[model samples]
Target: MMRVLLAVLFVSAGVMHFVIEPTFTAMVPPFLPAPRVLVWISGVAEIALGLATLAPRLRPYAGWGLVALLIAVFPANVYMVFDDTPAIDAPRWALWARLPIQALLVGWAIWATEATKLVRR
Candidate 1:
């Protein structure tokens, strides 16, 4: 089901955060302090949210937390697009496309967790 997929996605991403720490660290905008700290914290949050989403009673909170997490990490996505860092090596279109993809992910989390509906603007 959607819930299971979300859990896997988050868990895998969380693990990758550690496995490929430098790649993620490069995405952090220069304005942000302590890239290593942010990367580790984000990874931990992803793992926690992924596990929490599995619990029916905690699904709502986990979903909202994911939404916040996605929003919080968005600047890194932006930084990637502009910097076009060779570290990730993603195609230009794919890099730009990640913006809307984040919204879609937020919607997916809401649907999977049965949280409040996301109204399209």
Candidate 2:
């Protein structure tokens, strides 16, 4: 089920935030001017969002939470592409591809949550 998948995805990503803090820090938005605090906060937010998306009763709330979370994190992707932030060995375009890929993940979360109607007859 989509719910299960979303839950697992969130939990896994949450774990990564803590596990790979340094790599994550390296991806912070360059325009932010402060890297450490921003990276820490972003990591925390990812953990929170990942955990929040797991409960059945909270799926709707988590759905919206994910939407907000995605929007909030968009800046980091933008910074990665535009600000010359290191891509952790990824090619420049693959790094840029993250922006749209994020949208796909968000869409997957929405579908998994079934928060909105997708099929119109």
Candidate 3:
């Protein structure tokens, strides 16, 4: 099911934060004075998102949380394209592609959570 897939994706992406810490650190926004701290925070958020998405009672909150988180962290995505972070290992367009795809992820998370009828009362 799509919900299962989204949950798995979130889990995998959350786990990847630790696995790809250095690369994520490189994508941190220039305006942020402490890139390393932000990276860690994002990692923690991602892990929380992943876990939240898996909990039926928490899925709707997780879905909306992910949407907000994606919007909040979008600056990093922009910086990666703008600053040309070599650590990402992607083409210029690929970097640009990440932005809208993130929005799509927000939609996906919402639909997945709703389709499962997991929203708490």
The candidate maximizing lDDT is 1
Q: In terms of lDDT, which candidate is stronger, 1 or 2?
A: 1
Candidate 1 lDDT over 18-106, as tens digits, reads: 99999999999999999999999999999999989999888888999999999999999999889967788889899899999999999
lDDT of 3 by residue, 1-121 (tens): 8877886776777677788888888988877878877777777777787678778878788888777888888998888888966788989998889989998998897887773354444
Q: Model 2 — which ten-residue stretch has the worst lDDT?
A: 112-121
How many pairs of residues collide in each model? 0, 0, 0
**Candidate 3 runs further than 4 Å off:** 115-121
lDDT of 2 by residue, 1-121 (tens): 6677777777676667668767777777656667767666666666666666676666666777787788887887777776554536677898789999989988977777765632331
Alpha-carbon local distance difference test for all models: 0.91, 0.71, 0.79
RMSD in angstroms between candidate 2 and the native structure over all alpha carbons: 3.6
Total backbone clashes of candidate 2, pairs 3 or more residues apart or in separate chains: 0
**Candidate 1 wrong stretches, greater than 4 Å:** 117-121
Clashing pairs in 1: none
Can you give the TM-score per candidate against the true fold?
A: 0.93, 0.78, 0.86
Which lDDT value does model 2 have at 64? Answer: 70
Error of 1 at 93 (Å): 0.8
